[model samples]
Structures are given as structure tokens and as C-alpha cells.
Target: MQIDVDPQEDPQNAPDVNYVVENPTLDLEQYAASYSGLMRIERLQFIADHCPPLRVEALKMALSFVQRTFNVDVYEEIHRKLSEATRDLQSAPDAIPESGVEPPPLDTAWVEATRKKALLKLEKLDTDLKNYKGNSIKESIRRGHDDLGDHYLDCGDLSNALKCYSRARDYCTSAKHVINMCLNVIKVSVYLQNWSHVLSYVSKAESTPEIAERGERDSQTQAILTKLKCAAGLAELAARKYKQAAKCFLLASFDHCDFPELLSPSNVAVYGGLCALATFDRQELQRNVISSSSFKLFLELEPQVRDIIFKFYESKYASCLKMLDEMKDNLLLDMYLAPHVRTLYTQIRNRALIQYFSPYVSADMRRMATAFNTTVAALEDELTQLILEGLINARIDSHSKILYARDVDQRSTTFEKSLLMGKEFQRRAKAMILRAAVLRNQIHVKVRGGGTGAGAAQLGTHTWAHGLVSIAVPSPGREPGGADAGQQPVPDEHQHVRVPAGPSRRICTPYPQLPALLEEPLGSRPRPPAWTPV
Candidate 1:
């Protein structure tokens, strides 16, 4: 039988051919039709394990082999074993048995040359299609470019595949074509690990408005959108943007994405539920993840994520985090999450804290530490971060070892208002006292300057309860002025304590003979400080 070999596969290194059994003249019908397919699986698995670049191609070949051999007239035992081997190969390539046989190693230089040639050929095809003038040819040309993109993608050449798909989109006239192009771009970007590009393309396609409305009516459109959203969710999850990832996953339709081969049904449940738990409050988790309609479908695929979330919902936070920790290996090995596994663990810890403390106004540090399976210092650090970011309105009384929640209610508002009021009143009162002293000095200067009977200019006057006593002092060139002996000074209600307006003037005082403040009004009285006895 003629072997159906891939064009890109190099000769001289064909896998598993029994040289002894080769006879050029032998009847082709005597050979097994399935032998080559089975060998292909082994070669792919071995190559994939040895070279990560071949992993995607290996997976696709394995899928095709299963469909062709199993669904047809293949033996049940053989089919089952093949399927199991393929699964193990795909899941744990490194661990697959070599069966005492070695496959040919990949030629890196040849691969590089082949990849370059393929890209050059694709570019030529794109140029030809663009130069062709016929409108009827556009659709066929678009499909050609699209098929080229798919081929490149199967080869793990994502960058070129993305370019081909973008070219295909330019010629798309049908709604179906448009949606497929968008999905293709998203798929290619996902493999490239270009998360921002994936998001950009998804948003642009979704914003078409017709997409949502059409996605509602057309099964194909609906399927594309579902897969698109799921892809975006995975990208967001990989970036540690848990809340956004949760929203995208929750909104995605499950009918189109519950496949074991595509983003596995298990991953959806794990990513969605974990992200929801991380970002949402307890009530939000109940409403959006557990009680949501899409959740019912997603959970059916993988109940583990749902179970972990439920445990958290039940306040078994320690158990939930422990379960996640125990499953760390599984999570870390995930295709989209490998880079962010540690961040995911961090999210789990933070979520646990939020969930455990939601119902309580404040929790004791020691008790919280025990509940979270963490040390007191670490717990304090976490709480401190949460508090500083305003994620939690609480404070730690370091001395008392009490963590108290700040009151955000009306009573607290009133307390704050009272504090502000006291400060404002004190400020205004101090200002008023200073202003009064300055004004009284101005009046004293004016009164003394106008007095012709004065022996000296009075720079200040003290109004007492008995009377207003203006003690005039000698001007700079004159003698000291005294109170009139015949007329006892009467108090002026309009005037208070006065000082000279001139900046050079001073109010002299000898401590023992200081004036008595009995005549001063209580609120306006200037009393010496407690340390300075009158």
C-alpha cells in the first residue's frame, strides 16, 4: 500500500519500517491499512515528547488516527488501547514508553529551512490573490488563505498563521466568514500567547452588535462567540486578571465549548469557578457562579471546581485552600496557566481570607491565622495590604492584638463631624483673640495721640469693670504722663485691651506688679499661663 505521508515530513528518517519485510514486488493488499496510522501515533508522541514545538501537530494527528481507525472496522481492544496510549501521550508526553524502540530525532536546521520556505510560499499565494481582479475569485482566495493559516497553525507556526487569517478577513463577505475569521484570529493569538491581541480582536468582533444579535439567531455564530469568549476568559485567567476572566467565562455559552479536545470541559470549570471565588464576594459567588444558569452546564463537566467553591461557601475555607494546594501540580501544568500558577495560588489565599471574614465585622488575628493555615505575621501582612488598599476597612491594634473594623455607618460620620467642628472652632477663636488685641492697640494709639493733657503717649490701655483707665505716657521728648487726680477714669464699653499701633512700641511688665484681670470678661480675659503665676 502507498503510504500517505505529510509533505513537510522529511525522507530518510521514516519511523518504524521493518526493513526485512520490504519486498517491492509483494502484493500491496496483504499489508495492514491501519499499520501506518498506528506508527504515525508513536512517532508523533515520541517527537512531541522530545520537541515541544511538535506537540500541537502531534495532538491533531492523534485525533485523526482515532477517528479513522476506531469509528470504522478496527478491533475494540486495539481501538481502546490506541485511544488510551494517545491520551497518555498527549497528557504526559515525557512519560510515554519508548517500547525499547527509538524514533528519529528532529533536524532543527531542516525544520528552520522548511518553516521559512512555507512562509515564503504563503506570502506568494497572498500576493497572487490580492493582484487577481475578479470579484468571484475573492471568496475562493479567502478560503485558500484561510486553509493556509490552518496548515501553518497545525505546524505550530502561529505568527504566520495569524497573518494569513488576517488577510482572509479582508475578503470576507458573508457573516459566517466574518465570525470564523474573528475566531481564527483569536485562536492563533491564544497559541502565540498574545493575550492583549486576543482581547482586542474579541472586543472588536463582539462590538459589531450584529454579532450578538446574529449569534443569538445563527447556530454557527453562537458557537463561534461561545468559543471566542472562552478563549478570552482563558487569556484573562493566565494574566491573573481573575475578575475579568470570571465574567467572560460566566457569560460564555457551554454547548459549543464542553469538548474534551478543545479547551477541556474540566479546565472551564476549574478556571471559571476559581476566578469567581477569587474576585467575587460570597453573595456574588452565589448569584453569579453557583446559582447562575451557565454554571449548571460548566459544573456538569467538572464538579471539582464547584465542590471546592461550595466548601468555601460553607465557610470551610481552610479545606478549600488545602484542596487547591494538594492539586497544585495539576493546576500548574495547565497549558494556559503554567506561567501564572503561583499567582493563582495567591488568589486562592486572598479569596479565602475575604470569604472567611465576610460575615464578621472583625476577626482576631490568631483565630484568622489558624483558620487560614498561616502564621500570624503572614496573616498580619495580608490584612495590612488589604486595609491599605481599602479592600477591607479594618485596622490592627498592634499593642492590644485586636483587629477592629472601622465603622462606616452614620454614627462614625457624626463622630468625624464632631472632631472637625472642634478644630474649626479652636482655629477661629484663636484668630479672633489675636484680631481683638491688634484692634485694641490701634484704638489706644489713636486715643493717646489725640490727648493734649497727656504727659506721655499711652501705647496701651486696659478697660476694667470699675472704669476705662487711659494711663498716658510721656512722648519721646516729654515727661511721663499720669492719671488725672480729680477725675476717676470710667470704663468704655466699646474698647477692650489696647496696645500702641506702632511696631516699635512695647508693653512693659514687672511680674509682681502685674495688673489684676478681675475686671476682664471671662471669655475675653487674658490670663497668664498656668506655669506663670499672676
Candidate 2:
């Protein structure tokens, strides 16, 4: 069948007309077999021609093909051209018009996609080259293994990651790269909580000097020291070695003092934990008390730090107050009150009286006076209740009568025999009152300077009351040799009869000059009787 074909419609189907033979006809097989190579050369020539304006995507594709299918010569040529093109693109004049040969828009997504594809292709090529007996190929395989190991590590597969990293370290040609790989391996080990490995790596990183010398003295060294200390503390705590843990915590505290920023929640936990552990030891408690007292005194020197600590402790102040109350009841009572309750009460009353008159004492003394007054008031109410209850008791005995007589006698003797002692007690009590007055006066002075007269008048009235009480009390009689008489006769209302002549003479002669009620010395020396109540 004769088919009419249009030459323009199918150019390849047209019969070749032998016009004139060239000097040598090109062989079709040689050309067909070399088509890929020829096409690569042509593509490269086109890129080279366009040079500076070569599209990155097009160049990448062309180079990739050249690398995959072509021989080393072709691949190298393509690589050289690609490098030249990249350089030209990078160095191109900013003012040059890019309108003629539009470069592909560098969308990061597209670039990444292409990179992934290239990597996959490279991986396949690497697998293919694994059996090849060449130094370069072996080196490439080594790098591929290293890269795979790193990938596993980044994905959190520590075991495989470590293996890959170790391989990388072994095969790494550059010292810097090897060092980096080693550090990275150590970091992974730390993350994995491999303490031994961490220690080893830290030691290695330290010995290297480069890593050690890399950070600031205060920042780097202090930070690492803090971590090490914290880690050590945690270890000790885990081991249930409480004393060691406490020591570690103390060291950590010192370290944290150097870097306050490191006083994080974890550090606080460590501190609290250690403190709890240490509190079990009696020696530790004593040490803590001494330290705390010293710290409080030190706060006086550093008011700012003191204020911070105060605020910090203030949050726990209620609890601390409760603890203080318990300790006072338990320890302080046993130590100070149990053996010397009567003496303590007398001393407290005396001190309060003396401080009341001392205007020279500070406001703190006035506060103490107020506290003492409250204590005395409470004690007096308690004693009054006890006495009233005792008087109502149905099972009263002669001993009870004697007890009642002694109580009555104690009160009466204050006005009869021991006028000086009563006056001294009254003076101390007045001193306490006067201390309060002084504090009020200071406050008034602060508020209105010389303007206020009310505080002074109030103070005068308080002092007068104190003096009246002092004069109403009697001087205490000395025993035959001035020794204290045990179980002396109890004097009741009926015992207010006339004193014997010699004793009355002694009582009527004004007692040795008593200390000024308003100006009792801080010393224990007996005051002269000149200031004694009339």
C-alpha cells in the first residue's frame, strides 16, 4: 500500500536523500551509545555559556546526571562548571539586571526536597560502591556510616548513634571534626544518663584544654562546678549517705553563692533535702543553731542581704514561731525555769523595773519591757486563779493553812521588813515602765520634735505610781548572821503587831541608801540607801 506522508508532519519518517557524502560519515552506533555523554557535554556547554546566570536547579540536575551515568572525566568537568556557576551567582553584581535569564526561585521547601532526593541517590550509589576496592570509595563508605550514625543519634537512638559516632571519630581525617564528634558523643552519653561515660567524657573534655578554655571563668567554670557538685550530691542522696549528701549540698550552696542564677528549683530541692537529712544529727542541729545565730548577727552588717533573708524566712515565720514556742516550753523551761523559777521571776521583775527608768536604753529594750509586762500580767492572773481555787478546796489541811500563811506573809513582809528589797523590785518594775515611756517619748519626738508635752506628763504619772509602791514596802530583816532563814514564821494580818524594840529600831533607821529607782545600774552592785523609798 502506497501511503502518502507529509514530510513536515513527521520529519523522522522522511527518507534520507543522499545529496553528497561528507569526508567521513559518522557511525550511528558510536553516536547512539555516546548520546548520554554527548547530551551531558552539550548541557554543560549550555550552562558554561550562560555561566553567571545558570539556574541552580538546572545546574544541579545536569551535574547529578553527569555524576551518576558519566565517567570521572565528565563528572569532574561538570563539577568544575557547577562550582564556577555557583561562584558566579554568589559574586554577581547586585546592580546587574537578572531579567534576561531568570534564576529559579529558591524556595527552601523545594531545595530541601531536592536535597533529600540527592541524598537518597548518594546513598544508593554508596551501597553500590561498597564492594569496590578503592581507597576513595572506602573513605566515602566510612563517611556514609558516620553520617548515618549521627542521624540515628539526632533521632534519639543512642546506641546506634554512639556506634556511628565512634566510627566517625575513628575515620575522621581532620582533628577539629574528630574533636567535635567526640564532644557530641559525650553529650549524648550525658543525655542517656550514663554517669560513667559522662565522667569519662568530662575528663576527656577537660584534658583537651580547648573546651576547658572556651568559657568564662565565672560563667563556665562555676557553672560546670555547680553541675558537678549537684550531680555528686544527687548521687550521695541516692546512695542514702545522708552526711555525704549534706556536705555535697553545702558545697553546692557555696558554689551557688558565686553564681546566684544557679540557685534554681533543683538547687533548692537539694538544699532542703540535705537540711532535712542533717537535722537528724544532734551535732548538726547545734551547728545549725550556731550558724543561724551567727548569720542573724551577720545580717546586721549586711542589711540588704538580711532583708532578703528576712523576707524569705518570713514566709515560714508562722511555722518558725510555733517551733519557737515548742522549744521554749520544752528546752528553755527545763534549762532556765525548772530549777530557778522563783529566782527567774524575781530577776525578770527587777530588770523590768530598772529598765523602765533608763531613758538611755534603746527602743528594743522598751519592746522587751512590753513583752516582760505581758508575761508578768499573765503570770499574776494565773497565780490569782490558783490562790482563789486553793481557798475553795474542801480538803484543806494544816499544811494548806501554813501555805496560805506563807503566801500572806510573803506579801506582808514586802511592806514590813524587806522595804529595801521591795523597793528594788519596785524600782526594776518602774524601770520597765519607764523604758516604755522612753520609747513613747522618742516616738513623740520623731513626730513633733519639741511640740508634744503629753508623753512627758504620762511618763511622770507612771514614775510617781512606781515611787509610791516602793515606799509602801518594808525592808527585809537579816537573820541573826544575815544568813537566809529557812521556813521563817509566816506573818498574816494578825501578825502586824508591834515589832520587838531592837528590830523596830533597826527598821526605823532608814535602810542603807537604795539605788535610784529611775537610774539602777546595769551591774549587780547593791545600791546605796540614799535613794531608798521614805
Candidate 3:
């Protein structure tokens, strides 16, 4: 803004390296040239040697541009190869001044100060990236953190690595990078033996579109998914979730050219086949586990795995257990698999018991011992355990030395079901009654008034031959011969009757004794209580 030294007279000053970074007025075209082509590399070397603070900032700014200019893989290669070459220039003397104004020597104390200042600059970069509202810079920072996470992972510091990877994933703007970060997290989680977290990470990785769908089509991705699935299966097996373990192993793709680092084909077979043998029912074992395509692929990896499973499915119970016992040496040696050996064998034993008892209603414990190649007492103990687990619906006759399956009462079950239905119906009926009462109150009913009286008459259309006649007539509300303001009936065979529907109303039908009744005049001796209507 003011009169400054002329460009021709003043030193070139390392090609405008002294320009104000905050509000520079230098021609952007000239400054841009210094960061371009061969000049860019030279300037980077110069800055790294001379300005440590600016070097970190420049690495933060320029590395991503290089990564974009080439690619991630190439950037990684260049970073690995050329980083030290550039650092060597830190000790080299500063280049001759562009305008013959020799710059000060590279000061160790000044560089020491700049190196510390670089961290502050990077911290400022962190804050700037937060406030900068752009996806590109955010993704750059994510990738930066990803590299740091990878370093921590290599150092076996999973706690800090997980922290970095988690932040990297959250800052990701693209699905590709997000999936990469997820896989990183899963890797650390597995190494840490955080089995529960491994399952969750595997689930997330499997559901990701880039991973799950392409798992089979892409060899690398498929291998990774296979490993993940295998890890999850092992976790399940460790937890004694044999059925879930079988499903996970059965879903894995093991035929790809790429193989997992931890799980071998044999490992897959043993874990998958044993889990299947333990949890699968007869039909499921044949259709989904032993004969399924995935299991078949696993079989090719290790035929013995399938053989053991097929033996169990065919009811060769003793053979299956014997095979597992013989192969214990090799199987128990696997690092990924050795942990689950006991539980797997226990499951095999339980399956053997289940298959052995399939056809028996009341098998003697001695015969069971013969079939299983064990003592009668051992067989009895196994049966008791099975019964207690609710796996077998039977009771042991300790005295008779026989095991009897409890006969299920279908009638009792049906009766209980019917009772439940009736209770539900009763509750619904009461609700309907209340609803009906509410509706009834909402409508008005009109009734006609009675003049003489409200009368109810019964019409008789049938007459039996030689049948004695019985007639019903309305009675006075007040009891006759009792203390009341009512008249008593004359002494005759006629008796009073009451009809609930027609209280205080006349019947209107003639009396059955009409012709023979009224033989004496009512007004003579009795005078009809002096108020009777004649």
C-alpha cells in the first residue's frame, strides 16, 4: 500500500517467501508458479529444511493434492520412498539468493522452534478444517488420521488406534473410505480379543453394500468377508452358540483365490462341521449344513471335516465321536480354532447321545453302554444330563434301570388351548356388553299407555283328549286372608295365579269354570265386601 523497496533493487527473497500469508498482495500467478512442477518439489525440500512449521502445514496442504494428482497407492509409494530423500536436504546449505541477497544460514535453534510451531500449525489446521465447511478437506483429514491409526495399529496400541479409526470413520464423506476405516476397526478389535466388538464390526462390514454384495464377486473383498465371517463364527462357538456359529460358517465364501490370514480351509471345516453336527436337526443337517454349497466348498478345503459331519448325520454316532478323538492332535493345534476344541467335543458328545436315543422308547442303560462303548453308569449319567437340559423328554426309572419317554397328552394340551380360547371369548363378550349398554343409552324408546290394564294372554291351540283342564288367572297383588285392604275370594275351587310378565294385569281369557261358576249371587249374603262391582 505504501512505497516499498523496488523489486529490481530489493532481493528476490526466495521467490516471495516473505509475502504476508494472511493478506498477501503478491500476484497469485507468480506465487502459484513457485508451488508448481519442479519448483514445487524444490520449494517443499527448501521448506522442510528451513521452515519446519510451514513444512507440516505444507504437508497437510500439499500431500492431499499429490494424492489426488497421482492416487492413494502412488501417494503411499511416494511417501514411503521420497520422504527421507526430502528430509536429507534439511542439512544442506540454503540455496544462493535469487537476487544475490544471501539469506541467513539455516539456524538449528530457529528450526527447533519452527518444529514445535509445526504442531501448533497442525492444531490450527485441525480447527480450520472444523470451521471450513467443505467435504474435500474433511476427507483429507480423515485420511490423515487413518494413517496415524495404521501407525498405532502397527505399534499394537489398539486403544489409541481405535480412537483414531473411529474419528476417521465419523469424518468420512465417502462410502469407500468409511468401509476401509470399518475394516481397520475390525482388525484391531480382533487382535484385542474383543470378541463382542468383533461380531458387531463384522455385522457392520457385512451389511455395507461395497463389502457384502461384492464379497463373492471381488476376490479380496470376498477373502476379507470370509475371514470376518469365520471370526464371528469362532466367537459364537466360544460363547457356546453352536447354532449361530454354524450359520456364520455356512455363509462364508472360502473358495476365492485369496485366503484368510488366520483361518485355513481345515479350520473352516472343523468349526463349521462340528457346530452343524451339534445344532442341526436331522433334516437341517442334510439339507443346509452337510449338503449346502458353502459347506461343500468347505469340504473341499478339508474333506475330513465333511466326513465327520456326514457320519453324525447318518446316525454313525460312535464313529463321529471316535473320529473327533483321533483328530484332536491336529485340530487342537490351530491357533484360531484351538480355543473352541473342548466345547466342540462336548457338542459332538451331546449329538451322539441324541442320535443314540432316537429310536429308543425305553432302552436299558446296559444296551446304551454297549452302543456308546461306555459303562452303564456313564450312559445313565449322560441321559440324566440330557433330560435335565430339556433336550430329551424322558424320565429315568432308577429302580428298573430303564429310561422312559414321557407320553405327551394331546387331550390335555387341547383342553388347555380350549380353556384359553374361552377365557378370551369371555373377556371380549363383556366388552361387547358394555358397548351395547352404551349404545342402548344413546337411543330412546316410546311406550303406549294402558287404559283398563296391561294384559297378557296365553293362547292355547292344542287340546289333549280326556285331559284335565288347568287355568291361570291374574291374582290380586295383596295376599288374600292376610292383613291388607283387599277383598277375599268366595269359597270355591278356583285359585289365584300370578304371571310375572303381566303383573297387576288381567288375563282376558275366560275362566275354565265359566259355565258352572257364579252359581250364587254375589250381592246376597256376602254383599261382595260392600264395594264389589256387581
Candidate 4:
């Protein structure tokens, strides 16, 4: 019996030891040139770990670069890897003699010197921070902490760097201080591959009052926002949320994309383009990717990715998929994109298949296979999966090799929809008619109490004469002597006033300026009340 154990994944560090890259078309020199600091060193190390052909060269570049910083440990580590890689190359049967292939001798003196300088600098920063705290100067304390974090980061101590950066939070005096602190923490977190921390700080920085309320015309704010978006994109990509990652990358302003420590303009194009291709529908791809003015600038940095997106949108599945495959090797070399390449490609292919059959009620599997650049059997299997997943409302005939859309009773559906619409229209029409009647009658109702007087006695009195109805309101401070004086007061709640069934007449209510008459129910008319001028 064989037992297979899944590799334990560490939340802090994810090592893809089992994954290897045999062929990569990356121009190592040009790619390294696009980044700086720890970003350049880390990317080169990642390439060395994954691709054998480029291992020695990548390690050599990393070694050369690491010496420029105070990171003595990483320098020695890269040197060790370089030694192993060089030996492996030399032992190869097809190995050719090369002079520079051998690893460089370790610089013990420089390492010792750098460590001493680093320690001395750390002591000075700590002393300065303590002095700032003693003096109670917030800005000085904040800068002191940031300086320490920067030194720690330079020494390749990401944990200490993150801690120092986070510690600066307590000394932050304003929105700017908080944003700067967050950016520092976010940068170190990205280097540490702490994606959740990166996202959390990105949100914090963005929510800062200065960043959130910043005007678009502010160039500095736009640049900062671009950095935030790019960092957020990397985190979302690592989390396997292709759509959200695409949105984040797409939102980055080309003119403001200057985060060389993490990504380049070309990276933005590739990451956003591929993720959008895999996740965006035809309309979204066209509207957000192809038609975007800002993203167009990014796409110009990588014409191949831009072309793939255009071809996909134009419904040229064969050309698009072929282009995607051609670039697969280069994409696999990207540290952030490598793990998701296969998944993204599969999604893009499936989306293409779905789009190809969208407008057709039935399609011939043979032609579909040719269009998709796949065999009939493969196409049938794909269609089967899509059918089972409910992505396509269709049925497959195995013998005929035909995919047919399921029949739907459009007539019944249309009839049902029309009936619902008609009912809604009837309801609206009734409401409108009621409103019109109320408006035409000029109804004015209020919940005020009927105060004591002739007004109180006459309140809510409805009198009908010649099919006309008039509402009489009691006049204040007047005795009730009308024929309906004995009528009881209406309840405090709303009173339902009814309209006569006969032909409509102009609705008359008591007005202050007009002389209103009081009447009895026995066909008797009382004297008109005196009019009071306002």
C-alpha cells in the first residue's frame, strides 16, 4: 500500500518545491532591470528555485545585487545556492567549460563589515527613537521608527522591519503620518508574502482621510492611489480571486504606476489582461479592458497581452487560445502569476467554448472542434462538463455529435410576462385614477381637533343639495344654531368622506373669505354665515 501525503502549507511562507519549470522564455536581464531592491533579489531567487536552465544565472545576479545592500545573510544564502547550481551544471554530461560559470568567492571581510555597520546603525536608531519618545515629539518618533524599519528591511529582516513599521503607528500625528506608516508596513508585508496583511494595510491607507477625500487633480494623491491599487491586485491574485484582482490592476493609473519595488507597467498589463480574459464576459471585456483609455496605456507596454485580449473579444477563439499558449512559458516565470496560470488558462478556454455556442441554438460538434482547435472527443467531453455544470442549457447527442439547446416554450413565457405586465398596469391605472379624483375634488384633510364653537358643531358635516356635497367646518367662538347642531362630534381618527353616486359636482368646502351657508336636512336653508376678511 502506498500512502500519499499532501504537503503542509505554511500560512507565513509558501514554498512550491515540487513545482518545476523546464522551459522559460524570460529575458532575465531585462526582467531584473525592471525592479530594484529586495524585489529584484527575490524575483531572481524565485526563478532560480523553479527553472533549472536559469538557476545559475539567476543566483549569480541575485548574489551580485545582494552585495549592494546590507543584507549579508541573503548574500551568503544566494552564494551557497550559486555554488550548488554551478556544480550541477559542471556535472552535466553536455556541460561546456566556462570561466564565469563558477560561483564568486565569499566576501567574508565585507560581510563582517556590513554586519557591524548594520548593528551600529540599529543601535543609533534605537537611541534616537528613545530620545524622541523622551522628548515627546511625535513626528520625530515616527521618523525614527521608520528609519529603523528601513534599516531592517535593507538587512533582509522582514519580520523586524514589519514590526518597526507597525510600531510607528503609535507615533503617527496626522493622516499623512498614518498613510506613510501603512505604506511601509504594506511594502514589507508584500515582501514577506503576507497577503492578508498587505490587503489590510492597503485598506487602512486608502481609508485615511487624506487619501479618501483627495481630489483626482492632485498628482501626488493619484500616484499614491495607484500604488495602493497595485498592491491590492497582487494580494487578490495570490488569493485566487481573478475577477477582483483584475479590477484592482485595471484601476491603476498608468502615469502613476511607479511601484518598481513590486511590479512594472508590463506586469500590470499582463496580470490584468489575463485575469480579465478568464473572468470577464464579452461586454465587460470590451467595455473595461478594450475601451478603457487609462488601461490602454498599460496594455501598450505588452502588445502581446493586449492583442490576446482583442482577439478574444473579436470572437477569434483559435487565434486567441494559440496566442495564450505561446505566452504560457513566459507567464509561468512570473512568481505572482505562476501558481494560477493553469487555472486561468482553463477558465479562458471554457469561457471561449461557452461564448462560441452562445448565439447558436444548435452547433455541429465537428465544426466546433475545429474552431476550438481540439479533437471531436475532447470537444464532446468539454461540452459534457459544461452541460452538467449548468453553464450551457443544452443537450448533447453522442451518436450525432450535435449540441442542441434545450427547447423553451417562449409563447407561454411571453404570455405569462404580458399578463403580469397587464396586471401591474391595471393597478397603476387604478391608483392614478384615485389620485386624479382626489386632486380634482381638491381634498384637504388635517388631523387637528375640532375646537369648541359653531365650528366644532359643524365640523365633518356633509350636506347634499342638487347632487353637490359641501363639507362644513365649525367656526371658532360661534354658537351652534344650525339644523345639524345636535349632531355628535366625529371621532378623533380619520373620517371617511363619501362621494355621492350621482353625477359629479364641484366640491365646495368652507373658506375664510367666502360666506358659507348652513342648511337643515328637512329642505330648509339657514342664513349665510358672515364672511371674515383676512
Question: Global lDDT of each model?
Answer: 0.60, 0.39, 0.57, 0.82
Candidate 2 at 66: error in angstroms? Answer: 39
Full ranking by TM-score: 4, 1, 3, 2
> Model 1, 243-362: lDDT tens per residue?
999888887777766422236555677788777877787789889988988777888866667678889888887788888776664453344554555566676777677656656776
Give the best candidate by lDDT.
Answer: 4
TM-score of 4: 0.76
Which prediction has the highest TM-score against the true structure?
4
Query: What ranges in model 3 sit over 4 Å off?
Result: 1-136, 207-227, 257-259, 398-400, 411-415, 418-534
By lDDT, rank the candidates, best first. Answer: 4, 1, 3, 2
Write the residue-wise lDDT of candidate 4 on 225-343 in tens digits: 99999999999999889999999999999999999999999999999999999999988998999999999999998999989998888899999999998988788788899888888
Q: Give stretches of model 2 more than 4 Å off.
A: 1-150, 164-186, 203-218, 223-534
**Taking the tens digit of each residue's C-alpha lDDT, what string does model 2 give over 397-492?**
222221112224557766786888888898677757545432422211111122335533322211122112111121233222234323342332
Clashing pairs in 4: 455-474, 455-475
Predicted structure 2: lDDT:
0.39
Clashes of 1: 8
Give per-residue CA lDDT, model 3, range 1-534, as digits (tens).
888766644242222333222321223223223333222433343343334334333433344444323123323433543455344434458733234222222234543554455455456645654554355578677876776665554333569778878888767776567667777777666556677887887787778777856757777777667777777886787566889988888878757523333345656777878778777888888888766876687687666666787777777766767777777644543334555666667767887787777687777877777767778788788889999998888998888788887887989999999999999998776555534432332211111221222221121112212332222222323222345314434333223222112212222223443222223333333211111111
| lDDT (Cα) of model 4 | 0.82
Output the better candidate (2/4) by lDDT: 4
